[model samples]
Target: MTVLTIIADIRIKPDEVEPVLASYRNLIPQVLPEPGCLQYDLHQDNEDPAHLLFFENWESRELWLDHMKTDHLAAHQAATDDKIESLTIYEMTKL
Candidate 1:
């Protein structure tokens, strides 16, 4: 089975960083227990508090896609709406 790796790079508006972080705090726990979820860790950029990343591992792309459609994920997105400056998601496989 091919493990799927997801790197989500997010830039939050300077003043909205705290709110966005709070949303992630709620989202991560919901994600970790889901089927095929191997890891769903969040990271902050030391130099730039407004920049954040999610380094995730899943059993397969299909499971990850299902995760994307989950209610918790939608709530997070709604909560952070307009607070995100930019977002980038990279889906990959190990060599």
Candidate 2:
């Protein structure tokens, strides 16, 4: 089976890191139990507390797409909307 890897980098506003991180922490457990989810780990950059990264592995691209449309994902976006400085997502396939 091909695993779909998603590397998401989230840069939070200088003073908003804590709240944003809290919201993301709340999101982790919800995502881990989703269908086709193999791994969904969150990490913070060593030198920058405001830099958060999500390293994810899903069974397929389609299942990941379903995850993107989940209510919890939407709630997370709403909670951290203006507090984020930049967001980047990379969708990859394990070779």
Candidate 3:
């Protein structure tokens, strides 16, 4: 089985950073109990307060895709639409 690692590089608009950050915070407990969710943690860039990073480890790609379809994920996406300056997701596996 492949172990999937996901990195989400997120940037929030300057004026919306604080509000969008709350959205990020709200995702943690909701994700931790989900199946195949080995890890789901957030990080912030030291030099840039507007930048946020999420590191996720899942049992497989399919499980991660399932996560994307969840209501919590959709709600967060909807809430952050205007606040996000940029959103980039990278999925990887061990060589």
Least accurate 10 contiguous residues by lDDT in model 3? 19-28
Give per-residue CA lDDT, model 1, range 1-95, as digits (tens).
89999999999999999999998998888999999999999999999999999899999999999999999999999989899999999998889
- The number of the candidate with the highest TM-score is 1
lDDT of 3 by residue, 20-63 (tens): 98988897889989999999999989999999999999999999
- Please give the clash total of every predicted structure, in order: 0, 0, 0
- Residue 1 of model 1: what lDDT? 86
lDDT of 1: 0.94
After the best TM-score superposition of candidate 2, give how far the Cα of residue 82 lies from its true spot, in angstroms: 0.5
Q: Which ten contiguous residues of candidate 1 have the minimum total lDDT? A: 20-29
lDDT of each: 0.94, 0.95, 0.92
Q: Any residue pairs clashing in model 2, and if so which?
A: none
Best-first order by TM-score: 1, 2, 3
Off by over 4 Å in 2: none
Residue 75 miss distance in model 2 (angstroms) = 0.4
TM-score, one value per model: 0.97, 0.97, 0.95
